[model samples]
Target: MAASPTPSVSRAPLGTVPPTWLGKRPLPETSDGFGVRKPTPPELRVRRFTLPDTVAMLPGTGFASAVVTPAPARVIARSTWRPGCPVKATDLSWIRLTFRGFDGARHTGELLVNRTVVDDMVSAFHDLWDQRFPIEEMRVTRRDELDAPPTGDGNNTSAFVCRPTVGSSTFSQHAYGLAVDVNEFQNPYTKGDLLLPELAGSYLDRSWVRPGMLTPAAIGAFAKVGWEWGGNWHSLQDRHHFSRDNR
Candidate 1:
């Protein structure tokens, strides 16, 4: 005799309400099980949307490729690190996501940020992604590469530079994994006659408003989470620098 076919368990569709248990009433279609109703369009805001329990999606449909994840062992080993650093590997996270490059094609890159602001960092990038902003490149600051002279390092979009203040003995916010630099080539750090990226002299003319430059959207995104951009500073302007502290 042929055995009866096994019953298959049905599953709810993504973003839809799940099935009700034997004793419970069916949940509202819009309820997300946390008693909060999902906001409709126009009210929907950027969110940390998780997919497959490992990837975080950016706002909008086409950006599903944009995801954030913990740093891999190889990434940690390559990043600028040393003993007695203010932040340890456990205190930081690695986010891997797709970003639009200056050429308008998708590129995958990684960023290392403190766990304290990982969510904020992701949110900032999400806003940038939604705006279709261009990022030159994003990579971890490799310890081995830090020894190289800083003459033409401005184009590197990096975070967690384990270093102290340029002229002070105190550790900089970057040493704590609390700061980030974006599109350094297009957003040079300027102080007096000095420019970090010697080749980025043209970007000093912010009125031009070109790709890879800081736009209002980018500023608003970082500011929303209490980060201060170097572009807004006086005395010394580091247009590529963004940190949690204004000092």
Candidate 2:
């Protein structure tokens, strides 16, 4: 699967498949290539607002669990989807699952993904949950939030945003609902001076090994289902990303 360029306003023709690593290039020496030369200020890492957990956990059912169903019409209405998007709403599924939060409490979260990969995503997240991987939050991406003012410290775990690739006019795998971004603040996307969540520079220091940070084991959990981790990419590191096509 080819990776789309950075987020852009132009749209690709319907059904057009983007080329792999479309606009990727080597990072400059000054760029934080896989290590951090300077740390971000604590204030910059703080979230502008914290979203309250939306689901309650029941007592004594201490195992990872998931529920999958057809994508709800209401969810679609709030999502970034519009007609002519790469994937149809009917081909997507809504998933709700239990995850361990940074606070070490179990919480329910939701995602929207292509129906074909629904089982794979369920299995991968269950493994993470069992391993006690901490995710700050998980929810559907709303259309209004796509270009909302950057909170800088967002860590929303989400899948599916109907938009072009980061720097190109091509549709992102995300447009097809085949990609997921987990804990964006803890494991951010970085490429040649560009960071997805602009204030997440501190997380570039993979050596810190904080909770919610993805490990080799976590990568393996997704790999088990044939999903590729962007952390493994050479030109850029999207540590929070996982996708079916190595995008």
Candidate 3:
């Protein structure tokens, strides 16, 4: 009998077979899409179809944790105050504070308030920040822009406005930069059939609380500074308002 033909063997280049066909190898440590480094030599010895006691291995499982730095000191600039207003700039200050925005991100806001309340404003806002209360916007109201309609107009977290109280010629507390209206769209000024934003009917029910609405904690925060809430008004309810009046 002829000698058995030598067994034949076939070989292919390293590039021939798909990677999946090869034996499993350690995944190379790489940067996550967000630039965070993925785990190397993973903390857990997870196997196929088996979950670890802790899920720390899951991608993005942990939060970066919000870091609210020390609230910065108040900053003053020309644009921070309205030009030639009834209230002198010297009596009013531009306060810069860190606020949590409606989107849950950190933001810097400016409030033009009477100098007497700057310290109180800082302490109050710091408490608000620690509580993560949301603020829509905060800026100094320009004297020229005060002529715009107060009701149904777009403004939020404004302090100073040279305008009279509704239906009264007497200047409003805002005219003296002693009041602040926060998250107006979420906590509107209302009286009878009228609403400041006009579109804030949803917030009419004080029972239903939402982000940016004044929680008891927020009210307490301002109260600590001797600020009164407009929600306590007799006729109209200005849930978003806070002022240090009759102090």
Most accurate candidate by TM-score: 2
lDDT of 2 at 127: 94
- List the candidates ranked by lDDT, beginning with the highest: 2, 1, 3
lDDT of 1 by residue, 1-247 (tens): 9999999999743322211221132223312121112221221111111112122334453443332345566767888877888888777788766666655655566778887888788788878888888776677777865554333323566778887765467888888889988887668777776665544566677887766778878888899989999888889998988999874
Candidate of highest lDDT: 2
Q: Is candidate 1 or candidate 3 better by TM-score?
A: 1
- Model 3 pairs whose backbones collide: none
Q: How close is candidate 1 to the true structure, as a TM-score?
A: 0.71
Ranking by TM-score: 2, 1, 3
| Model 1 / residue 173 / CA error / Å | 1.0
Q: Write the per-residue lDDT of candidate 2 for residues 172-213, one digit (tens) a residue.
A: 999999999988877888777777666577777788776677
Candidates' lDDT values, in order? 0.65, 0.74, 0.59
TM-score of each: 0.71, 0.78, 0.63
Candidate 2 residue 208 Cα shift, in angstroms, is 1.2
Candidate 1: which stretches are off by over 4 Å?
1-61, 64-70
Q: How many steric clashes does model 2 contain? A: 7
